[model samples]
Target: MYELKEREMIFVFTGPHGAGRKTVAEMSGSTLGIKQVISCTTRPQRPTEVDGQDYHFITAEQFNEAQAKDEFIEVTRVNDYLYGIKNSDIEKIFKSSGSIYLILNRFGAETLQALYGDHVVRIFIYADRDTLEQRMRESGDSEELIATYLSHYEDEMAYREQCEHVFENVDLAHTVFDLTKTLDQYLNRNLLELD
Candidate 1:
């Protein structure tokens, strides 16, 4: 049987862009009462996102200043935009919850694991190339950027084995179900009262 230690855990979901990492993380966080780490980003916020909720949208200068202060636990540059998770945010969650969900890039996920050791549960998510492209397009990404992401997909997927669990996100609802079930088994909880 699969096992995760009994304690509040840091759940980090990561994968190539358009693989539904954020979608699944949001669903799981809502259902399981897990706090999510809202990352700070230099990218423009989408219309559907609210400031401080989906992300803490910031200027590049602000991001740079924070980075210089050693405030972020991990930082990555994607398509020229900077994305990072604040160290204080993770520390607060660790002190206050049964679990916390982090939607991260592969680099951020790796950094979390290295920093937190056994308290971190890494879940790698992915989908077929066509599905990835479709999701990216649906999100209004430009063709040039989509191509760039596609080109990096293989390299991103190569980190799969380094993760503690891996899921292929083919269908959002079904995938969410499976992920929550896996989390229930992993953390030993009826996280959503599904029983």
Candidate 2:
């Protein structure tokens, strides 16, 4: 049988842009009573964003140093901006009173799965081409940027197997509820074993 450990199963989630991965992360964490480390990035924060909550803002030098120290479990460059998950932050979160989900991209998610396959669970969120395009438009994403991200993550039809769960986010309300149920069971069983 596939047994998930009692300490906590870390979830590394990835999806194509506009697939609502971020929202899913937040909701999943909330439903499971855990924290979600939003991740750090060199990308400029938008007007409505905050430093510590939205992301940990870092400079190129700081990012490179963090990588050199092996402080990040996964680091990837997107459009000349560096984004990463801090190893210490993840450790502290899980070691503390709550669990934490590491929100990731395709590149980062694959890395985490490979490195921590025994302790981490991976889920992939995908959308149909038309649905992806619609979500992009609804998010106020520019065509050029959307095109760049899609090409980077590959076509919506390309196959990926690292994920244990494949969720279609076109109709996100239903998908969100279903995902919450899935995560609840995972977290509940593990938490029980820990006690």
Candidate 3:
């Protein structure tokens, strides 16, 4: 007889690039002691990124092989590099009795929601187009890259209704405060409140 393991809820932060989703996800994960699910990518790791912490960097051949095995829940190509989330990663989180958090795009968020059903909490982070563009510039992105990134804002904003919550990343402290509260309520977790 197969005994089912208890499932831990997954919190997903998603939005257009330069929306500050990653910042919110990382902070919330750290505060709650939830692990941020590292994505796998075929792109070369940047000097600032550590393997397994930033991403599971792999060869293009390895990525294709995993794809052939239907191992990825979602995959996307960005700037000629492939990035994906493995189904096994989610299973690992469930097995460890810990929740998972991820910063993904809309497609990835939808895929996770489909796989996890109600266990998945989709948060669509956003800011005004001007604010996002300014943030991208402040982050040291080239003008061309900033333009390319914000071009998809409208399309991404269209997916906002698909998410469980919409968060505006205006003030960092306030944004994280709301995010923690929302996540705690959704997961029925008391990790945030010290009482």
Candidate 4:
């Protein structure tokens, strides 16, 4: 059976595209010494992103083959691309870290929550639509792709109520500070319960 160690936990970062979920997750994870479980995606890599660091960019065939082999713990299709987290990746992180974070969509977060129950913490981060669009534009996304992302914003925002924590990511530094503090409290509480 799959199980986390007493100190291990999974943090799922979820929100609409360009909501700063990845930024917040990375910043908080760095501050808290939590590793990030790099996910595999069939989307084309951006010029600024590193292949293995940002994501495991794979071909559609490769993604399908891995999914067929039951390698992914959760998989979701968004904007005509596939994204998933592999079971092995989580295990690999746990070998050296007590906690890990995953950048996921609403569906992916729900899947992990169902699988891990209390062991998974779901956090939803969001920004104003204008901010979101500007972020996407700054990231070099095409206008069409940005529009496609925005089209799903409402659906993504609707999931915020289901998350254990929600933050408006207008200011990155402040958001990261708040997130780190909250995560620390959660981890401490879990430790107390374990004892």
Strongest candidate by TM-score: 4
State the lDDT of candidate 2 residue by residue for 62-173, as single tens digits. 9888889888867888888999988777766766644567777767877877776756777788776667778777777788977887775564335346577888876767
Candidate 4 lDDT at 174 equals 89
* Consecutive 10-residue window with the lowest summed lDDT within model 2: 186-195
Which lDDT tens digits does candidate 4 get at residues 1-195? 258877679999999999999889999998788999999999999888999999999999999999999999889998789999999999988889888899999999999999998899999999999999999999888999999999999999999999999999999998998888899986773322221
lDDT of 1 at 29: 76
- What's the TM for model 4? 0.93
**Which pairs of residues collide in model 2?**
none
lDDT of each: 0.85, 0.73, 0.84, 0.91
lDDT of 3 by residue, 1-195 (tens): 112245567888999888889888898888777888789999887665799987999999999999999998889887788999987886776666568888888888887787778878899999999999998888787898788888888999999999999999999889998888888876666663554
Residue 136 alpha-carbon offset, candidate 1, angstroms: 1.6
Instruction: Encode model 1's per-residue lDDT on 1-195: one tens digit a residue.
Output: 112246768899988999989889889777777899789999998877899988999999999999999898789888899999987887677666777888888888888788778888899999989999998899888899899999999988999999988999998898888888888775676555445
lDDT of 1: 0.85
User: Number of backbone collisions per candidate, in order?
Assistant: 0, 0, 0, 0
User: Which is the better candidate, 2 or 4, if ranked by lDDT?
Assistant: 4
Residue 194 Cα positional deviation in candidate 3, in Å, after optimal superposition: 7.2
Misplaced by over 4 Å in model 2 are 1-6, 153-159, 189-195
Ranking by TM-score: 4, 1, 3, 2
Error of 3 at 164 (Å): 0.4
Query: Model 3: which ten-residue window has the lowest total lDDT?
Result: 1-10
Whichever of 1 and 3 has more lDDT, that candidate is 1
